[model samples]
Target: MHNRLHLTYANQSDQEYLSIYGKAKITENRQKVDDLWSSFLKVWFSGKDDPNLALLCVTIEDAYYWDQKNNKAVTIFKMAKAAITGEKSDTSDKGTLNI
Candidate 1:
């Protein structure tokens, strides 16, 4: 039963990931988001196992390059995390925010 629940959660996560990826892929600027994501991973989180990083990266791409309204939310979330952890966000580094 425990394994079954874990499997279900994994499946749902994969579906959500695919949904986000599909949204980006179908956009007029499809390759831009993917390229930015690849650079982000290479620079900041290479070989890390954090599953939600893709979602965060996609959110950043949409908010910044696509002029989406979610930038405030992302900024607040990052600020909150930094406040709690007392560490500056690596995402603020030069070229990391480029799309």
Candidate 2:
């Protein structure tokens, strides 16, 4: 299993990245199961009290965020725009947070 993943969150400005890093753990805690119960889970489970409900919990090792980060489609547009405008293709605002 992979021990780490690079999580990316969209932020409008460089100072707004909401990224977080950690060791991922999974659980089926009943309290958590009930709190986040959704109709989607009903497709596979009997109900909130179903014994199969699983929740993802993480032990954060680090976190970071980047601002002005665009999703794939937007990034493509930025590249195209740069091609036409002769301006530097800006993918996003760069920033980092280690926590």
Candidate 3:
């Protein structure tokens, strides 16, 4: 498993939107996103049975297929899976999942 997860916007518009939203909504909780992913990784690597794993996987799958129009979400899910599997993904210079 990787140690970090890097999120990149799918396009300039998406990047700008996230920048604005982050500044406005997450200004006081900048680490909220990172913390959430960190917790997810921890649970994933715990080696113990986690009932939520199935739900989480299903949710990601749903987002990838149902939200196909949202390139950002698709990229995130793809990269996240690659990170967990220690496999090289098709991720380009566009973005990355550090962990």
Structural similarity to truth (TM-score) of each candidate? 0.21, 0.50, 0.25
lDDT of 2 by residue, 17-37 (tens): 577777766786787776888
Clashing pairs in 3: 4-98, 4-99, 5-98, 5-99, 6-97, 6-98
Assess candidate 2 and give its lDDT: 0.72
Name the regions of candidate 2 deviating beyond 4 angstroms: 1-19, 69-91
Sort order, TM-score high to low: 2, 3, 1
What TM value does model 2 have? 0.50
Greater-lDDT candidate between 2 and 3: 2
Q: In model 1, which runs have C-alpha deviations exceeding 4 angstroms?
A: 1-70, 90-99
State the C-alpha lDDT per candidate: 0.37, 0.72, 0.38
Please give, for residues 30-74, the per-residue lDDT of candidate 3 as tens digits: 344344445546645552233342211111111111113346777
Candidate 1 residue-wise lDDT, 1-99, digit = tens: 121111111233222211111122223343554555555475666533434344322222311111222355675787789999998854332112233
Compute the lDDT of residue 52 as modeled in candidate 3.
41
How large is the C-alpha RMSD of every model relative to the true structure? 16.9, 5.4, 17.2
- lDDT, candidate 3, equals 0.38
